[model samples]
Target chain A: MIEILKQGWHTTIQDLGRLGSQSFGVPISGAMDLNAFQWANKLLNNNSSAACLEMTSKGPELKFHEPSFIAFTGAIMQAFLNSKPVKMYKPIEVKKGDVLKFSSVTLGCRTYMAILGGFQSEKVLGCRSQYKGVTLEDRIVKENLLLFNRNAFTQKGARVKTKTTDYKDVNLKVYQGPEYHLLNSHSQNEFKTKQFTISPSNNRMGYRLNEKILQQLPEIWTAPTLPGTVQLTPDGTLIILMRDAQVTGGYSRILQLSDNALNLLAQKSTKDVIKFELITL
Target chain B: MNNKLPFTFFRMHPKVILLEWEQDPSTETLKELTHFKANILKYSMGVSQITLGYCSLLVQWKEDIINYSDAKKNLIALYSNLSINSTPAKTKHWTLPVCYEGEFALDLAHLSSELKLSKDTIIELHSKTIYTVYFIGFLPGFLYLDGLDSKLFFPRKKNPRLVIPKGAVAIGGKQTGIYPNESPGGWHIIGNTPISLFNTKNETPCFAKSGDTLSFYAVDEAEYQKIQCVNNPKAYLTKVK
Candidate 1:
C-alpha cells in the first residue's frame, strides 16, 4: 500500500483509457504522453497496460508502506527519495516507510510515475483511467491510499535510458484529415507555412491553437473524432483533440496527428510555438 | 468524389480508419450507417473499438503495428462483400419523466417571452414530440436528440452558462438534449429529468443507443423527488416499444 502524502495538480490514474465505450459517449481518458507512459512500465518490466499516476505542472508526494520498485518518466520533474535526489527513467527501490516527493517540472508540462506491478484501481469500462462522471473520483487526492501488487520477481540488471527532450523547435507531424478537401487551395498552401502558438485554454480534452487561419468552413455533420484529430472551428481556430476528448464533434477535421507527434505535443504548454509538418500518406 | 464507391475510407491514424457515407445525413442515411457499422464490427476480427456518428463510422484495431493498406482493404472488402440490407437491432422508445416547475425550468420564462409562446405551451410542445436519438456526444450520456418542435425553436445562449446543472433538459436551435452531467453549455434549460441518464455503476452506463427514441413527460416536483430518491431511478423507465 502506498499513501498519498501530498496532492499534486491534475494527478489521475490512467491506462490506455476507457476503451470500447465511445458508443456510449464516454471520453477515452488516458495518459497525455503515451511514449513516457510506456517507457516507465518498460523500465520496471511491468505490464505495458499497467496504470500510472500522471502529474501535470506539479507532482505529488507519496509514502510507501512496503518495499516497492518504481520508475519515473516524462516532463523531467525534480524528485527525491528521503531527501536524496533521483533521476527520471530509472527503476528506484524504496524500503518500507520511505517518503517520495516530487517538485516543479521543466522542459515539459506532464509527468508519469509507474510502479512495479502497476497501480491497482477499480476498472470502469475495462480501463483504470479516471474521468469526471465515469469514475468514482476524477483525481487522486491527498490521504488517498493507493493499492499496488507486491511482486516477488526480481528485475534483471539492465541499463536503459532515452535522451531527454527540450521540446523546443519540434515539428508536430500530421496527415490530412477527412475534411481536408474542404479547404480552399490557397488556405491549404498557407496552412503549412504558418506557425501556430498553443493557447492558454488547453487541457486533457484538447489544445486550442492561437492565430486564426482564413477558412470559413461550415460545420460538418457531427462525426467521430479521436485523440489526434485536429479540428478547425468556423472562426479558424485549431483545436487538437487529446486523450480525454469526446467521442464525436461538429467541426472541420483538417488534420490528424501521428502517435509520435501526439506524445511530443503533450509535453508542450501554453505560448509554445509549433509548426505542423504534413506527412502525406 | 469517387462515384464508384458508396463510401470513402480515410486513414485517421495509422491504427484508425474512418468510413464515411456519400449520401446526405437523414433518418434513412443514419439507418444505413447503423447497418454498416454493425456489420463491420461483426464481420471483422481484432477490432478494438468501433463508433458511428451522423454519417461516418470509425474503426480502431487492437494492435498498434497495423499495415494501414491491408486494414483499409479489409474494411473495404467487408463493406462490398455483404448486402447493406441486414436486419438492424430493434430501437427503443423511452418515455422519460421531467419536472418543469420552479428551479428546473430556468429558461422557460425567457423562452416564452422571446418566442411569444406561453410557458405552458413551451413545456407541452417539448414533451409532445418523440425525438430521435441521432447520436451521443459532447458529454457522456448527453444524447444528441432531433425532432424538436419548431414553435419552441430558440437560438443558443449568446454567452453560454459556465455550469448547466446535470439532468437539465434544454433546447438550442432545432436540437434538444439533456445535460447528463453538469457542464458548460449554451443550451437553454427548460426542464429537469428525474431519471439518471448516466450511471457508471450500471453495466450499460447509458441506457439509450443511437437508434433509440426519447420523449419527456411532464411530472410534478413531488414526483421528481420521489423518483430521484429511489436508489434505482432507471428502474422507473417506461420502455414503450
Candidate 2:
C-alpha cells in the first residue's frame, strides 16, 4: 500500500483507457505521454496496460507501506527517494516507509510513475482509468491509499535502461484531416508556417493553440472525433484534442497528429511552441 | 429504396477509419447508420471501439492486430450487400419525471417571454413530444435528443453557465437533452430530473442509448422529493415498447 502525503497538481490513475466505450460518449482517459507510460511499465517488467499515476506539472509525495520496485518516466521531474535524488527511466527498489517525492517539473508537462504489477482500483466500464462521471473519483487526493499486489514484489526484477527525449520546440507531424481542404490556400500556407504556443486552457481533453488560423470554415453537423484530432473552432482557434477528448465534435477537423507526435505534444507545457508538419501516409 | 448509398471512406487514424454518408440527419439516415454499425460489430475483426455521429461512423481497431486494407474491403463489401428493406431495431421508451420550479428552471421565465407562450403551455408542449436519442455526445451519457417541439425551439444562451447541474433538462438550438453530469453549457435549463441518467455502477452506465425514445412528464416538488428518496431512482424507470 502507498499513501499520498500531498496530492500534486492533476494526478490520476490511468491505464490505456476504457476501450469500446466511445459509442456511449465516454472519453478515453489514458496517459497523455504513451511512450513514457509504456517505458515506466517496461522498466519494471509490468504489463503494458498497468495502471500508473500520471502527474501533471507537479507530482505527489508518497510513502510506501510495503517494500516495492518502482520506476519514473516521461518529463524529467526531479524525483527523490528519502531525500536522495533518483534517476528516471530505470527501476529502483524502495524499502518500507520510504518516501518518494518530486520537485517542480524542469522540462516536460507530465510524468508517470509505475510500480511492480500495478495499482489496484475499482474497474468502471472494464477499465481503471479515472474519468469524471465514469469513475467515483476523478483524481488522486491527499491521504488516498493505493493498493498493490504483494506477489508482484516477491519476484526479483532487473533495472532496465531507456532513452528519453527533449520535448522543447518539437515538430509534430500531422495528417490532413477530413476537412483539411476547407481552408483557402493562404490559410493553408499560414497553418504550415505558424508556430503556435500551447494555451493555458490545455488539459487532458485538448490543447487550445494560442494563435488563430484566420480561416472561415462553416460548421457541419456534429462529426466523430478522436484523440489527436485537430479541430478549428468557429472563432478560428485550433484545438488539439487529447486523451480525454469527447467522442464527437461540431468543429472542422483540419489535422491529425501522428501517434509519435501525439506523445511528444503531450509532454509540452503551457507556452511551449510547436510547429505542425504535414506528412503523407 | 436506392441500392447504391453514397459514402466517403477514409482513415482518421492509422487504426481508425471513418465512413461518412453524404446525407443529412433523418430517420432513414439513422436507420442506415444503425444497420451499418450492427454489421461492423458482427463481422469486423479486432474492433476496439465504434462511434456514430449524425452522418458518419468511426471504427477503431487495435493497431497491427488486423490488416487495415482487408478490414476496409470487408466493410465496403458488407455495406454493398446490405438490404435496406429489413426493419430497424426496436427502440425502447422511457418516461422520466422532471421538476420545473424554482432553481431547477432558471431560464423558464425568460424562455416563456421570448417564445410568446405561457410557462404552463411551454411545459405542456415539451412534455407532450416523444424525443429520439440521436447520439450520445458532448458529455458522457448526455443524450442528444431530437424531435423537440418547433414552438419551444430557442437559441442557446449568449453566455454559457460555468456549471450546469447534473440532471438539468435543457434546450439548445432545436434540441432537448438531460445533463448526465455537471458540465459547462449554453443551453437554457427548463427543468431538473431526480433520476440519475448515467450511473457507472450499473451494467450499462448510460440509461438511454442511441435509438432509444424518451419523454418527460412534469412533477411537483413533493413527487420529486419522493422519487429522490427512493433506494434506487433507476428502479422507478419504466421501460416501454
- Candidate closest to the true structure, highest lDDT: 2
lDDT of 1 by residue, B1-241 (tens): 1123478778777778788887667776666666667877887788888888888888898865357777778777766654643566677888888999899999889999999989888888999998888778888888988788888778999999999998999999878899998889998999999777888888998898888788889999999999888836456446745
Could you give the TM-score of chain B for each candidate, in order? 0.89, 0.91
Residue-level lDDT of model 2, residues B137-215, one tens digit each, is 8888888888999999899999999999998999898889899889999999999998887788778878777777788
lDDT of each: 0.85, 0.86
Candidate 1 per-residue lDDT over residues A215-280, each given as its tens digit = 799998889999989999988898999999999999999999998889989999899988999997
Candidate with top TM-score is 2
* TM-score of candidate 1 versus the correct structure, residues matched by position: 0.94
TM-score of chain A of each: 0.96, 0.97
Could you tell me which residue pairs clash in candidate 2? none
List TM-scores for all candidates, in order.
0.94, 0.96
Docking class of 2: high
User: What's the CA error at residue B180 for candidate 2, in Å?
Assistant: 0.7
Clashes of 1: 0
